[model samples]
Target: MALRHFFLILLVVSIWAFNNIAIKWGLLDLPPLMLTTLRFVVVALILVPFTRVNLHQLRYLAVLAFTFGFMHFSLMFISLNNTDAGTAAVIVQLGTPIAMLLAMVILKEKLRLVQLLGIAISLSGVVVLSGSPTIPNWWVLVLMLLSAFGWAISNMIVKKSPPISPLTMTGWLSFLAIPIVGCASWLTESDQITLLVNASWRGWFAILFSAIGSSIVAYSLWYSLLKHYNVNLIMPYSLLTPVLAVIMGVLVLGDSMNGFKVTGSLLVILGTAIAVINLRNLRMHAKLARFRYAGRSKGH
Candidate 1:
């Protein structure tokens, strides 16, 4: 990957790290499903006018809307409401391995041995983080895992679907998700009108930031990168998200942290660095070997 693209991924990670905080703040004023509904509303209103999709693309987008937009966001928000942002962040990292496995099975992408080791190390970190005392409920863990599964499935859909601009994908996705999540909110949540009317600026800002920063900007870039790179390569960068989220959760949300959390954070970071750096080294070595082989062929 180019340095610019790497930095872009880092940017997405940073946005998402703060996104955990945003959702936590938003939950102060709105129910989980209601907050998700409003988020898609904002996204649809802004991007739908600019989006264009065909029947074929729409088929993929509809599934993506449900899986990524509805299932992932709704479950994630609910889980975040139940658990600390840091714990939720760590748990969601399970999506990394899930996506990698799906890429191998669905997209037929291969992973290096080192990559596998890195994934294992990262998962062990997640395991350690899962034991954090901050996680208040076990049911939230299950919800988060399901949410991560939904996310992994959505990634496969994005990779398999025909080429589409990131903007179109994000727009149609948000548009399609509105009714699904909206109905969910209607059925399970109450006081939507009252909440929206009385929501603080922080709550509203959370909605706007989640809609524009996390959805429009971060996801669009993420989709573009997915189109260009293998899932195994792209997914590891997300491990860094939990580390940032944990730190912010401690500072901003007053979430607890301990030696175990610190160890897990370091392990996650180490695993991610190993995956990225080793993959780059492998590519460079392959290029050098190819150049040498070409020189020998020309001489012969």
Candidate 2:
């Protein structure tokens, strides 16, 4: 990777990391569901104009919108209401292993033994993190888990869907999410009108940053990188997101970090790195060895 792209990846992850804090800040003034609704409203306003989808794509996009936009963001924001941003960031990493498992079942993808071990380690870390005293309620952890599952489901949907630009998918997803999430907010949340009317600059800033900085800018740059480089080369950099989130949560939000949290975070990060990073390297190396062996056999 060039030095500029490396910096771009850093910038993207940094935006994503700060997004956790932004969500927490938004939740201070706006109701969780309401905050989610407003964020997507902004996203839709900005990106929907550029989106075009055929009738055949509508169903898949709807499912993607529901799973990724509604279920994932709704549950995530609600979970963040009860849990620390850093903890939420770490817990959502479960989506990765969950997506792997889903691929095995739905797409018939095979997992190497190392990947299985990584999943186990990551799960154990979640168990450890759940036992932390800082957790206000265990149910929030369940919500987070469900949120991760939603994200995994969305990933599968994306894999199965027809070729579409990331920005187009995101734009339609956000536009479609408006009604689903907005209705939920209307039905469940009180004081929405008053809250929106009285929301401070921090609340508005949070929504704008999440919609533009995190979703639009970060994902655009990220997809651009993925287009130029192999996925294996790009994915490992994402592991830094939660780590940065944890640091920012501590320093910026003053979120408490104890031994369990620290240990559990390390395990999750390490396991994710092993699952994604090491496995890719192993596959690449194995392929190279096979090619070299074939070359030597031909030479003889």
Candidate 3:
């Protein structure tokens, strides 16, 4: 990847890291489902005007809607409502391993020994973090994991789909999700009118931030990167999300930061780096070994 693209990836990671805080901020006045509904509504209204969708790929788009729109955002916002932003962010990195597994099964992709080790290490870190005493509830982590799974599955679907502009798909996806999430909000939550009417600037700011910054800008850039690079290469950058989230969560939300959580976060980052990096070098090592063997055979 070019240096500029790497920096852009970092920018996207930063946006997503803060997005957890935005979700939490919005949830103060809006119900989780309602917050999600408003978010997609904003996303659709802003970007849908510029996007053109193909009716032929409605099935793929629908699948993306379910995975990203209904499953990922709904569970994620709800999880953020219930959990610490940093913890939710860290737990969501489980999606990396989940995506790797899905790719192995669906795409017949192979993992290096280092990659497998990294997955194991990162997963262990998650387990350690969740088991720590600071977490308010175990079920919240489970919800976050489900959200991660949804995200992973959605990524695979995007990879398999025919080339479509990321912004176009995102806009159409927001349009599709509005009704499903809106209905869910109405069915599950009360005081929607009361809260939305009474929501303050902070709440409204959170909504706008999530809709425009995270959904529209960050996700569009993310999908564009996915189109250009291998998923494994792109996915590892997500490890940074948790680190940034932890910092923001501590500063903004006053989330507890202890030694155990710190250690766990480090383990996750280290493991992810192990799993995703040095693939080119690994292949080069294999080639060098083969060359040495060929030279020896000729000498014999």
Candidate 4:
């Protein structure tokens, strides 16, 4: 990748990393469901205007909206209410493995031996992370895990659905999600009117950051990169997001990371790297390592 493209990836990763902290900040002032609902509402207003949807695929789109937009994000924000941002970010990475496994079953997609191992390693890391003593509540992790599963399911749905532009699907997802999530928040959450009326600037900033920065800006940039580069080249960089989130959580939220958290994070990241990072790159790196070793041996 060129230096500029590298920086662009870094920029998007940083924006997404900081998004975790923003969600935590927003949860302090706004109810989790309410905050999530408003985010979709804002995104819907902005992007729905430009998106074209096929009326014939409304059912699939609705399913995508429910699973991806409503269940995934709603559960995520609720999970973040008690869990630290860093932990939530790391745990959510499991969604990749989860999706792979679901594909194996639901879509009859075959998993290579390495892919199966990757899934095992990722799940083991989730176990280790959840077992850590630093976590205030276990249920928070459960909710986050469910959120990951919802995300996985949504991806599977998309895979089975008709071809549609990602941007258009996202706009429709947010547009559809607004009512589903908004009504749920209104029904379950109390004093939402008061919460909205009295919400501080920080809370609003968090919503805008999630909707604009993470969803619109980051996703748009990501699609642009995918357009130019091979997906394998582009995707491996995204693994940095959780690592960056962990660092941001420590610095901004003062969340403590003990040995277990560190170890689990390493396992999760390594396993995901194995799963998603192109095997071609692995072979190239291996060849380079051999060449370097031979040079050192010759010098000796």
Q: Which stretches of candidate 3 lie over 4 Å from their true place?
A: 1-7, 221-236, 279-300
> Candidate 2 — which residues are off by over 4 angstroms?
279-300
lDDT of each: 0.83, 0.90, 0.85, 0.87
10 residues in a row with least lDDT, candidate 4? 280-289
Per-residue C-alpha lDDT of model 3 across residues 1-300, encoded as one tens digit per residue: 568899999999999999988888888888999999998899889988987777766678888888989889999899888878988888777777788888989999998888899988988888778866556788887888899899899989989887778787888888898888899988999989899999988689888999999978898899888888766567767778989999999999899888768877777777767776667865665687699889989999
Pairs in steric clash, model 2:
none
- Write candidate 2's Cα lDDT for 1-300 as tens digits: 468999999999999999999999998999999999999999989988877899878889999889999879999999999989889999898889889999999999998999888888998899899888756788998999999999999999999899888888888999999999999999999999899889898899889999999999999999999998778878889999999999999999999989989988888888877777765566786698699889989999
Sorted by lDDT (best first), the order is 2, 4, 3, 1
- CA lDDT, candidate 2, residue 16: 96
Candidate 4 structure lDDT: 0.87
Q: Report the CA-based lDDT of candidate 2 relative to the real structure.
A: 0.90
lDDT of 1 by residue, 87-157 (tens): 77776766766777778777889977886777788777767766766665667667888898898899898
What's the lDDT for candidate 3? 0.85
Sorting all predicted structures by TM-score, with the top scorer first, yields 2, 4, 3, 1
lDDT of 1: 0.83
3 or 4: which has the higher lDDT?
4
List TM-scores for all candidates, in order: 0.82, 0.93, 0.86, 0.92
Task: Give the alpha carbon lDDT tens digit for every residue of 1-300 in model 4.
Answer: 468888999999999999999999998889999999999988888888987878767789898888988779998999888878888898888888888889989899888889788778888888889777656687888888889999999989888888888778877888888888888898989998898889898799999999999999999898898887777778888899999999999999999989879988888888887777769766776687699889989999
